[model samples]
Target chain A: MISQLGDGFLALAQPLSFLHLVGGFLLGLVFGAIPGLTATLAIALLLPFTFGMDVADALIMVAGIYMAGIYSGSITGITLNIPGAPSGAITTLDGHALMKRGEGTQALGMSALSSAIGGLVGVVILVALAQPISALALQFQTPDKFSLVLLAVVTVTIVASGPLIKAVVAMALGLMISTVGIDPMVPVGRFDFGSYHLVEGISLLPAVIGLFAVCELIAQSSIPASLGKAVAVATIDRPRRRDFLPSREKIREVGLFTFLKSAIIGVLIGMLPGGGASMASFIAYAEAKRGSRHPEAFGQGSYEGLAASESANNAMCGGAVIPLLTMGIPGDAVTAIIFGVLLIHGLVPGPALLGENFHVIAPMFAALFMASIFIFLSMMAFGPVYLRLSQINRGFLYAFIAMISMVGVYASSYSLFQMWMALAIGVLAFLLRTFGYPVVPTLMGIILGPYLEEFLRRSLIVSEGDPTIFLRSPASLVLLGLTLLFVWLLRIRPAVKRGRAEAAS
Target chain B: MTRLLRGQVVFALGLAALNTVYASQLLQMDRPFANGEPGPAFLPLILCGFMYVASIIIVVGEFRTAAAARESAPQSDVISRIALIGPALTISATALFIVTFFYFGYLVSAAVFTFIVSLFFNYEKSGDLKRSSLIALITAFTVTLFGWLFFVKLFGLYLPVWEL
Candidate 1:
């Protein structure tokens, strides 16, 4: 393993691979800093080109993009209050507050530092525990897999901010969308609605593009531009490169423990299928607030809040890869595309992948670590420029987004129908958002729904239609218990406490 | 009553109606029940039922919340017509772009899409057509060129420049 790690580092040392890493990191940074664009879109746009590239190079580039993208989401959030990605939303709570207080440089610095710490910690844990975790995951049966997916689906819904009923509805809507094509088990069409295009169902790429990119265009159009003038009006001071570094006192205030705890939380969440960066940052941010000595300072530019969120989201990168590398499960959209990249190169991501292709996969690990370093370096390089990122012409930004999103969808599938599908989904999502429904749960529902149904039906078939089979398996039982525990902690307990408090008052 | 049966309430009803249709379709499918083996339609049927119940709960919740808010404090209920027009124009513009995308292909479609979208956002911000038009024209050309170069020239992704 050590020899393979050495080889991985050596491969990354090659000039061409290093260039790909730099290019991908820069691409991720640009996409992640720009509102309405994300690391997912950057990878999606790069997907077709991966056809010509070597597998190792592709993985290396993707690693760079993933790490840089997740970290850069906070750039716009800190400067503008518009999080470049949903993962940055939590960071924006404190990050934008700091920016409002004319400490944008300090906030960006702390964010970069925290992201580096989290990402490094996540990668270390990934290297150390990936094999063991995969071995344990391999022990999981069909029923257990169902319960695990169930745990993911329920937890995402519970964690989604809004009315629980609306979140469930959003999830249900996603599952329904996933069910549109042919049944996985029987190979018979379920809900084609008489159109041949419907038989193909909705592809993940178009759905993601429409939901995020297209919906963003429409959402931005709705808001008057006068609202954003406040950001421009704020007087920002020009700072030195050293000023981009987190102050020693600020680091002391945030403490190493908070960073470690948040990174650990991020890694654990990343290990779960469907546990994306947003959830990692959210849970970590909430925990930081819960455990803070000065909780009231949390939303008002607390450095600890920024550190907690940045650390968790970046750490999630390492955690997310664990399931993808060890098992074939992709934790989210970015990893899902990486799964496609592997398939194009005839490299399946499963238990055999590690044993057979450790040498080939090593550079990707190195790239992730290197990319984490770049996150900090990028702060020193572009910390000043990021403050002006929000001031980019809205006309150009939205126009660029609209072109890439629609064209990217068409380019990928070579199907005009898919582009239309993206538009339809985008409109639906825009309405869903306007009506106060959280869209992440919907995305999760679509991604996890097929697995949820397949495993459930397959388990039922194995047991001759007995429901008790779920509880019969120890692993499944334990997972289900965890699901219940999450519900209690995230949902029921909160409601009960709120009710009791209201009564007491 | 108009305030009580708001957009959310209407949306919930619409979803319930859609789910009912879905449920009926499931009933028409072969063996949706879990009697022998859970058929292909079984899961979808279950989902449809759940959606119906959830949508009903949403409507009820919205109604209750609206009632409580009304009783507690009455605020101005007027919503600006202009606010709705912006989103409408944006959605319609996007839909128009999709139409043009198929008929005109990548270059013309994207150029037009970007121009109109740029105009919309720019007009919202500045209310100056001269500035908005100049920026829109420049953006349309550059973005189109970038798309053509990146996807077609660099990556070899098939995006038609023009179509019948």
Candidate 2:
């Protein structure tokens, strides 16, 4: 494993591969630092372009984007009080407060430093555990695989923000979309609606582009430009590179223990299906506050709070990739799209993937580690530039997005029908968002639906129509139990508490 | 009904109707467990039933919430209308772009689509027609050129240039 990883590092050192990493890093920074744009969107846009690159370079570039995108979400959050991505929301609580206190540069510096630490720790743990976990996963039976995918589907549905029913609806809609074209296990056609194009099934590229890029374009169009102007009107002071370095005393104040603990919490959360960066950072921030010597200082410019959130969120990037590479289950939108990327390259992501293709996948791990280091260096190099990222002209930004997304879809498939499919899905997604439905679960469902169905059918066939096969396998039993447990812990418990509070009031 | 409730009900019903179509297609397939094995329609049949139950629950919940909101406070129609114009225009422009791209090909469709998109954003931001059009023209040219270079020259992906 170490030798393979060494080869991965050597691959990254090659000039073109290194350039791909740097280019992807810069792209992630720009996308993640700008409000209304996300790392998920940037990666979705990059999907079509991956067709032209080597498989290793494509994966390496995606790793750089994933790491940098998660870290840079805090940049705009600290600067303008608008989180560039959802993962940065917890950071904004303390980060913006620190900015108002005129310590914005220092806060940015501390954020970058802690994120690098967390990211390195996540990569180390990932490298150590990935092989062992894949070995374990290789032992999974059809029923066990079905249970695992079910756990992912249900957890993702429950964790999505808004009413649980709405999330479920979104997920069902995605599963329905996936059911189009042909039956996975049988040779019969289903849901083709009498069209040859429909029989080919919806491709992953257009679905991704439509869900993110086109949907974002339509969503952004509805918001009045005055809101953006208001954000741009805020006065910002020019700061030099030296201003971004955290003081030694401040570093000691946050402490190494806080960084390590938060990072570990992040990795653990990330290992769970549907455990994303936002949840990791939010839980870590709460835990940090709980253990703080002065809990009241949090949310009032506390460096500890900022460090905790930043560290955990970046670490989550590595953790999120674990299930994706090993089990072929994507934990969130970014990894779901990464799953598409790997599939596009004719590489199936599963237990056998690592044993067969470790050399190709290794550089991605190295890129994640290097991108973390770049996060810290970038703050020092672009401190001033980062402050002004949110002010880019909306006209130029959305126009560029609109053109690339539409054209990119056509380029990838050379099919005019797919372009129309993308636009139609985009419109539907816009409606889904406007009505308070979360889209992440919908994306997850599209990616995981086939596996969920195939496994269930296969297991039932072996059992001769006995559903008890799921309970017969110890691993399947455990996974189903965990799924029920997560529902109780994440949803039912919270609702019961809310009901009690309401009754008391 | 309040506009908010109306929109929610319409959207929910639309989904239910789509589900009905999907279920109808599922019925056309071989039944579940046909020939002593589960067929292709097995999981989708389950999903169809689930979607129907969930949709009814959601519609009822939305109605109850709307009734309570109506008793408590008046809803704002003006804000909703103002918020909708941009999306309406964007959707129309994008649909038109797709049609034109089919007939006229990439170069013309891309340039026109980008021009209109840039114009809408620029005009919305500044509310100045002349200035917005000028900036939109420049943006359209630059973006279209860059996209061509990136997709065609760099990636070597074939794009239709002039179908007409």
Candidate 3:
């Protein structure tokens, strides 16, 4: 295994493969640092191109994009007070505060450093656990698979930030979307609405492009440029290269314990089916605050707070891959898109993916580790440029996005009807967001719907329509119990606490 | 009624309507349990019911909240007209782009589509027609060429150049 992993690193040393990594890393850095553009969008746009590339190269490029994208989100968060991605929201608390204190360079430095540390830790853990987890998952029966998918769907819906009803609605909408074409269990078409295009069902490419790219384009159109310009006007003095390096005293202040603990928290959260970078960072930030001697300094330019958020979110990139490669469950949008990339290249991500195709998957693991080192190197290389990312012309940016996304859909499928589908889904997604429905659960629903339905029907068929079969299998029982526990802990307990607090007030 | 409440009610009703359409399709399929095995429509049937119930709950919740707000204090119901216009314009332009792409092929349609998108954003930002048009024109030329190069030349994907 170690030798195979070494071979993975050696493969990436090839010039063409190395170029793909650099290109993807640069793409992710730009997307992550620019508000309204995310790594998920970058990968979504790259989906079509992957059809022409080797599977290993495609996965490697995605790895670079994943690591760089998660890390660079905090760049603009520190400098501009606007988090480039949702993952950077927690980092923005202390990051922007430090920026206001004329410590912007140091803040950026600490963010990159901690992110590198976290990403490295995550990759190491992924390397260690991915194989063992795949072995465990290979033993899952039909009922157990159904239960696991159920846990993912329920947890994602519950953890979504909004009215619980709305999340469920969004998720149901996605599942319905997934059910449009041919039934997974049967050969018959279900909900074609009498159109052949509908019978072919909505492809993942258009769905992803529509839900994120088209949705974002329309949503951004609603916000006036002056509003964004107002935020961008807060400028900082240009610092020299040396100033971008964190001082020894500051690193010591943040402490190694804080970085490692936050990173571990990130990895653990990331391994869960619905756990994402934002949650990982938020929980780690809270824990960091709880464990700090100077808790009051948090959200007030504390290095400890910034390090914890940056470390955990970047670390989440590595941890998020474990479930995706081992169990075929995507924990978040970015990983979900990566799943599409793998599918495009004829790679099925599952327990057998590692066991049978470890050689093909190895380069991706290597790319992720290498991208972490590049995160620290990129900050030093482009520290000044990072501050100016938000100042890009909206006209140029959105126009590029509009052209690439729409045309890319056509390029991949060669179907104008699919392009239309992308547009329709985009509009629907725009409306969903406008109505305050979280879109992530909807994406999760679409991806997991087939698996959930297949496993449920298969299990039922095996049990001769007996519903209690789920409880009979020990693994299934454990997963179902976990699902219930998560609902109680994530949803019921929170609502109860909120009610009590309101009554007390 | 407040705009928020109005929008919420309309959105909830829309969802309910969509669910009804989906359920109608599901009814045409085999029953949930067919020949002693769960059929294709089983999970979808469950989802269809869940959607109807959830949509009703959301509509009721919106009305209840609106009633409480009305009793508490008067509030402005106006939503930003400018905000609505931006999305309307963009969506219209995108629809137009699709139509043109189908008729005129990739090159002409892409140039025209990118021109309009670039113009809309630039005009929104600077609110100056002449300068925005100049920038938009430059952006249109470059982005159109880049898209062509990327899809056709680099990736070896087939795209219609000038079908017309």
Candidate 4:
């Protein structure tokens, strides 16, 4: 085992491999920084480009991008209070407050550093436990997989903030979208309406990109700007310019504890399908506040406050990959895109890969570590420059954003139709935002809908479309019970509490 | 009602209605499999049912909240419900631009969209054609750069080049 690990380390040390990690990291940060761009979008957009590249190198690039993407999102969340991605949403609470307190540099530093630690720690756990976990996963059959996914669905239902009934509807909205186009058994087009594009069903990536990015833009346009304009980058910190910007001592203090707690949270959350870095960050922040000696310092921009979220969100990545590579389930949207990339690479994911391919598996683990280190150093070096990027004037920024949308959407597929679709969706998203409809779920739906639907279909096949099949499986039944319980907890119970509070007051 | 709140209700209702119409049609159309098993319709059926219940719940919640506000509050301080027209018109213009661009061409569409949406931002500022033209020129150049260099040159994709 040790020898194989050494070979993996050597392979990753090649200058090209290190370079690839750096490239992926920076690319991810840039994508993550942009409002309409995200880590998953970045990966999918980059996929066509890697069609001819070496598989190992390609995987390394994707991995680096994935890790860095999650980390860089907090940059925007902290400084601008606009999440660079959904996962970064938790950071906005304390991170942006720190910026408002004129501790932008400190928050940025703490977030970046802690995220690095979380990511690296996650990588270590992956190295040690992935094979063992995958071996355990082999015990799962269709019943288990269905149960696990159902458990995820339950989590989503519980976390949703509307009427339990409404959230269920929204989830069903996603499932409905997934069943379009073709049924897998007959493999014949079902809802295509005779269009070639429709036959392929709705492309999940475009839908995600549309619902999250484009629709969000539309929503933003509708709202009165309540918050001050997103903050402008004030200072560029380089060692040459200033020995160090994010006070290393402060970073170290926040980074260590946050990273450790975040890793545990991430792995546990990652083990569950519905849980991801965002939830981990939210929970960790709440925990950190609860346990803190300085609890009152929480929403007011405490250094440790920012650290808690950044670390946990990054740690969730490692936890997420455990289920993905081992059990053939995507941990989150990032892993979902990676799953798409894996398919593109001709690698079949499951116990078979774990059992037979140490050559691939070992380096992949080492690459995760190298990628985290590479991005951390690169962020320290180049991240301060990004402060300037955030401050770009709104008019200029809008114009450039428009330009980016036009180019990015059009470039990926020369089809004018797709470009138009992206614009339409973006505008719609912007409008939706104006109206106060939560937008993240729409994106989550687009990404997860297909997988959820696929599992539903396969479950039907294994059980002759009997609803009882879902109930008979212990895992599925437990998950269904949990779902019911969660609906009661988040949706029904909250409304009931509010009702009682209003009456008393 | 607060104009903003009213708009949200309308949009929410519209969204629910759209889901209902589309999902219901789908479930109705899909035939069951031959073996007396549930078919593709099952998921859609489940989805439509949930949407129906959820939509009703959401509207009920909205109305209850709205009613509670009406009893206590005095007249609203609406500057103008027309203030919403800016966003509405801007969005409408965008949708129209998308429709017309393919129907006519990019150049015409760009000119029209730029002219109309400018009204939303600063019609007075746009009167300074010096500034508006400058911004418009930049917008035009930006479109060219993104459409040609980034989209076409780098990625081997094509946009509707309205050179004429």
Candidates, DockQ: 0.51, 0.61, 0.57, 0.26
Q: Can you tell me the DockQ of model 3?
A: 0.57
Candidate 3 Cα outliers beyond 4 Å, as residue runs: A231-236, B67-80
Q: Please write out the lDDT profile of model 3 over residues B12-104, one tens digit for every residue.
A: 999999889889997688887777888988889999899989988999899888864332212212224546877898788888888888888
Badly placed stretches (over 4 Å) of model 4 are A1-20, A31-62, A76-107, A161-166, A194-196, A223-258, A343-368, A383-386, A395-434, A443-466, A474-505, B1-9, B12-34, B67-129, B139-143, B156-164
Give the TM-score of chain B in candidate 3: 0.88
Better of 2 and 4 by TM-score: 2
Highest DockQ among the candidates is held by which one?
Answer: 2
Residue B6, model 2, lDDT:
82
| Number of the candidate with higher DockQ, 3 or 4 | 3
Worst 10 residues of 2 chain B by lDDT: B71-80
lDDT of 4 at A135: 84
- Count clashes in each candidate, considering only residues at least 3 apart in sequence or on different chains: 0, 0, 0, 13
True contacts kept of 2: 0.76
Query: Model-by-model lDDT, in order?
Result: 0.84, 0.90, 0.90, 0.64
Q: Pick the winner on lDDT between candidates 3 and 4.
A: 3
lDDT of 3 by residue, A183-254 (tens): 997899989989988887889999999999999999988877755643543466667877889999999999
- Fraction of native contacts (fnat) of each candidate: 0.69, 0.76, 0.78, 0.23
lDDT preference between candidates 1 and 3, better one? 3
Ranking by DockQ: 2, 3, 1, 4
Provide C-alpha RMSD values for all models, in order. Answer: 3.7, 2.0, 2.4, 5.2
Chain B vs. true chain B: TM-score for each candidate?
Answer: 0.83, 0.89, 0.88, 0.63
